[model samples]
Target: MSHARRLQRELQKMHQDVPVPGITMVNTENFTQWQMDIEVLDQNPIYHGKTFRLNFKFTENYPIEAPEVMFVRAIDREIPMHPHIYSNGVICLDLLSSGNGWSPVQSVESVCMSIQSMLTGNTKNERPRGDEQFVLGAGRSPRHIRFVYDDPTV
Candidate 1:
């Protein structure tokens, strides 16, 4: 099946595993884009309890070009601290970035799990290096910010 259909099927199965209120999506006119939210459930530090809405925009070159994702809720969505995450939830994880790591063999489920793990592991309140300026500038807008992946371990 094409990757788009595959994603639709996978997302269907994922919904079965997640019954949380905020986690859902609907394909746009362009099947490459989706609107979804991730409700945090892990018991952790700093981000113990929060629901974050994220937009996932896949390119025709998906798997090759990692899906473009961004935070949706501006006020409550404070970027969680992590080595691979920018101040605006633009994740820099190798599994989701361009050349540093991601491969076509990886599935959408793995990506979701990685994001869950990343959030659960965070405990700091700071942004990646100089993300303060980035955040204040144009980090909130997805189309404007492009993440450059430098490190994998966060």
Candidate 2:
């Protein structure tokens, strides 16, 4: 199936089941790009009362490929401090990497939940090392970066 059709199907399912409470679809007008809101359920001091915006850009090869997922800074939302997340909104997760572990079975809901869980499990209140320099200088998309999966326990 085409990306549009698959997205429509996913959107339909999202509306029907609403599996992930922390994730809410913001826009689905464009299948290639989507917006969502994510919240950390656990009262992690780092993410308390914060709602983060996630931008998901899907390629034509989606499902077979992973979407470009990143946090967006807005009036009500700020990026949470995590070792795997850059200050500029780039996230370093094995599941979202195009180089590995991306499977056709993965959906936006699943990814969002994984991220929520990741944040919930984290105890460190620090951004990835060199986040300032990376955000100011890094101009490429998050998927292009060869981020070293330093910790699987996170």
Query: Best candidate, TM-score-wise?
Result: 2
Model 1 earns a TM-score of: 0.69
Q: Between which residue pairs do clashes occur in model 2?
A: none
- What is the total number of backbone clashes in candidate 1? 0
Model 2 whole-model lDDT (C-alpha atoms): 0.87
- lDDT tens readout by residue for model 1, 74-147: 55655555665665667766666565567776655566556767777666666687877766786354534456
- Show where candidate 1 strays beyond 4 Å: 15-30, 74-78, 136-153
Question: Against the hidden reference, what TM-scores do the models get?
Answer: 0.69, 0.94
Runs in model 2 deviating more than 4 A are none
Superposed by TM-score, candidate 2 places the C-alpha of residue 65 at a distance from the truth, in angstroms, of 1.3
Superpose all Cα atoms of candidate 1 onto the true structure and report the RMSD in Å to 1 decimal.
Answer: 4.1
